[model samples]
Target: MVLLRGFLVLVMFFLLGEALRVLADLPVSGGVLGMVMVTFTLMLRGRVSDELAEASRGLISVLVLLIAPGVVGVFFIVEQFYGQWTTVIVALIAGTLLSVLTTLWLMKKVSESAAGDGRHE
Candidate 1:
């Protein structure tokens, strides 16, 4: 029964992503869309079953290892990156800074809302 529920959750996420892609014209891949859908669902529900939690952890653990082959293939383009290294470095730095700022801003907004609710009570 637990396994069945986990499977159903996965199917629901996949369907949600597909529906979003069709309805909203999102450019992301189905799996990425599915993952975002699942994350949002978990956040909205505020809880996850033990079986599903375990499955998600296992999947996350193996996710990076699964992408290693493609990462290694980047070595083949080492020569191409030599001249473009400066642009790449700048982009990476800028992107990281933007991501950090955005994350902090969101955290601040959520915290302020929570604090306001507490003050009201």
Candidate 2:
């Protein structure tokens, strides 16, 4: 029930985004806009509900699978990327490193905050 509710919330946001995009004639995809909306809502709420957390956890576990199609599609565009392989490789490498560094920094900050909170108790 909790998982269902969480998924419902996500789907509702996506639908709302689709509506808004169609009405506003926005260039961004509905999914991306919906995600942004949900992110802002979550930020305003300050804390995640157990249902949403659980749903997110399940989704994370299968995230690679979810993106598999997009990854596979890249192979179909092999001809288009033939002349720009170097550029593509460099961008991918840089993006991966940046993501890793960002995650590392965030984790360190979070750990430090947790440690500080513990010391105050």
Candidate 3:
């Protein structure tokens, strides 16, 4: 029930963002906007509910599955990169490394902040 509640909250925000995107004819991703709203909402609330935390953890565990579609899409356009495989692979590696490093840094900062608040486990 807790997980369901958390997912519901996330979905509500996503739908609201998608609606706003369509209505505003925005070029940005609705999911990104929705998450920005979530960040603000959580900041205003001053704490994350355990349910949300659990839901996010679960999603992170299954994140690779979520990324599968993008990988498959690239396959469909494989010919487009006929001679640029090295460049593509290098870009992918660089991007992945950068993302991982950024996430690690962010998590470290968040951990420090949470520890200061006695919220770290």
Score each candidate by Cα lDDT: 0.85, 0.92, 0.91
lDDT of 2 by residue, 1-121 (tens): 9999988888898999999899999999999889899899999999889988888788889999999999999889989878899898999999999999999999999999999999999
Indicate which candidate wins on TM-score. 3
- Cα error, residue 119 of model 3, in Å, equals 31
Q: Which is better, 1 or 3, measured by TM-score?
A: 3
Ranking by lDDT: 2, 3, 1
Per-residue CA lDDT of candidate 3, range 1-121, in tens? 9999989988898998898899999998889889998999999999999998898889889999999998999878878879899898999999999999999999999998988889544
Q: Against the hidden reference, what TM-scores do the models get?
A: 0.59, 0.63, 0.65
Regions more than 4 Å wrong, model 3: 83-121
Candidate 1 weakest ten by summed lDDT: 1-10
Clash number for candidate 3: 0
Instruction: List, in order, the clash count of every candidate structure.
Output: 0, 0, 0
Clashing pairs in 3: none
